[model samples]
Target: MAQEQAGRVLRSVKWRADLTAGVLATWPADPRKRTSQEWEQVRTAIPGGEGLPSSVIKGRTRQAVTFLNANGRLPVDVFELEGAPRVPRMLLLAACDRQQATIERGDTDPGRVMLRLQLPTRVDPHAYGDWTWVACPISLPPMVPVSAVLHLPTLRVTGRQVRADVAYTHTVPKAKRTGHTVAVGVDWGLNTLLSAGALRLQADGRITALGAGGQFRAAGVLAKQHRLRRLSERLHAKADHYQRLTAGDQQHDLAGKHAVLSDEIQHVSARRANLNDALAWAAARWAVDQAIAAAATVIYVEDLGSMEAKGMGRSLNTRLSQQVRGKIVDRMRHLAAEVGVAVVTVPCTRPERGRVHFPVRRCEPTTSDRPHL
Candidate 1:
């Protein structure tokens, strides 16, 4: 039932985005800087625009405009979505009420703490009253603090499950920018996902390493990532070849094979994304745990956003480009924020320079500590 309702919302969002794209294609000026109200007025130009919620329409218009800004045009009509569409928060609230039901058995019992959400059955993003209320038991590996406040959740359908991503807010001590005696320096590497160690800022103006730093090695996971990447490349090559052979002729003999290949490519891409997400969380958790154990006040990470992979061989360059450094850094910041541990990204020098650009002066080699998988 949840899956069916989710499908309806997904279709609605896609339809609205496509409609907005059609309008923007003929637009003389750039549509990226338009305000929400300006975009809202465009609904009249689209047929059957009264069915969708204003919020959903606004959200999709922003997305369409972003795509246009990035790629200079809309995607091809045959483009398949990489993942499930996100249901706007307003629609979630309109479909259900009293979502903040507390557990009767108190906070200690995890089983009793469940999130009650209503999925709309009438396939209307704006209309209410035809909701299918479901009481989904909440479970997390980590315990939720009692003082935290729960906010509305965004729902998405993945495979056969309806995943609700819930977020909470709590107060934590603010991280300090200066007056630090001990800190951790995190460096990015190709083989070693991260190399982190603790350093002490001495009173006499000299810096010393506390101990041999540890490395986060995901050799097994990286191997699987590369394997999937190679498979994806092969699938894409074959799919492109099939497309060329068909020449946009849907009735061509190779059209069926091309469609199958496209579906397979999407499946493989989703698997790779899920793997990267899990790996990022694991790496971030390990980095935070290291800082906590070392009692470091701040974590200084290397900013390699502009780092180029051209110097290396073709294979090595491809592997480097596929690294999930951005995701890892984002997760690190999110986890560190909860504990008031500051994560700072410093400028990084080219790898050929034979030295990393550390935020602190004169550094020692990373620790010889055991690597964390």
Candidate 2:
């Protein structure tokens, strides 16, 4: 009676998104391979389009859907969507990979679909062993399936899936000045990416800029990547011709082309990886170095987990794109803490009410005017 009472009192959307991946594990292969139009039909025609959980069911290991008569082998996962489990609905998504095609816009109706996948995989990007966590089977709840609409303006229907992983992350401010302290104000701007002050906090508790000119190192790296691509194409063409001669009368031009393409792909991939590493390292080093110079224990940083933050999207700034900042900030916090420094992220905005604006905390906090960070 006690267990039933508790379950009845608390009704949740299953906010923990890991639910989708858990449910799809037992579902069979694509019963009816769906086209774009067919997928669209299912969405609009299906009951409770944006009110059900999206679930993903991957195999215990990898397996290809060889059953489909297509050019390339595709992986299949059975999924379920349910707003209320009492009358849950199931959908089978066949060709939902990166490369998908639709004839007419209306024919292919479903939007960007995000299926909850249950894989025995998680990532630990930081080399430091602090805050490393694994999602054991028991740790995460069941999985669900949900699709997000793409074409409609002002309509970001995130399917019927709930974000269970959503939660507030911040450190309570506890900064006891051990010696002379400096507060560095970092301003993230569009034209000028990041503005760092040489002397963050002045003797009279005023924030001042250090360098005269703005740093434009990121632009130089972008130019190098473009130049490398051009050079790589020329090299690949020359290499392909030479490689083709190695095969005689039965000379396989396809084999030569494949080898050249594979090498070029690796080169481009490695270059991009290096660029991202450089940016992450630069941000991490800057924050740590500023804290050390301030003669203070802890650093107050901006938390971008809130919804309304502008540059957090993928298009604007490569460094600020995706959820990389969250991981990077976590790594920096642990690194700072290890050296007796407190790293606290001040709340930027209230996400639930649709405000992700962070109140800018600067070098001189003990002042009347709000310092433009």
lDDT of each: 0.70, 0.40
lDDT of 2 by residue, 1-373 (tens): 2343334334333332232232223223452343545334433432343333221112111222332333253233222232333312221112222222111112342322323322223364444333332221111112211121221111112336422221112232344344434444343444444444434445675655445423324566545655655666676776666556655333565666667666776677667666655665566566667666655454555645332323456444343332235544655564554345555566544478853332223321211111110
Task: Give candidate 1's TM-score.
Answer: 0.67
Which runs of model 2 end up more than 4 angstroms from their true locations? 1-187, 196-217, 225-252, 306-331, 349-373
Worst 10 residues of 2 by lDDT: 364-373
How does candidate 2 fare on TM-score?
A: 0.36
lDDT of 1 by residue, 1-373 (tens): 3454587787877775566654554342445444555545555555665444444444455665666678876644314222455553333332344642222223676433466666667766565567666676766435455555565555667777776565666676677677777889898888899999898889997888989999999999999999999999999999999998999999999999999999999999999999999999999999988889998878888866446555689999899989888788878887777677788877766578676645664322222111111
Residue 270, candidate 2: alpha-carbon lDDT: 65
lDDT of 2: 0.40
| lDDT of candidate model 1 versus the reference | 0.70
lDDT of 1 at 253: 92
Scored by lDDT, the top model is 1
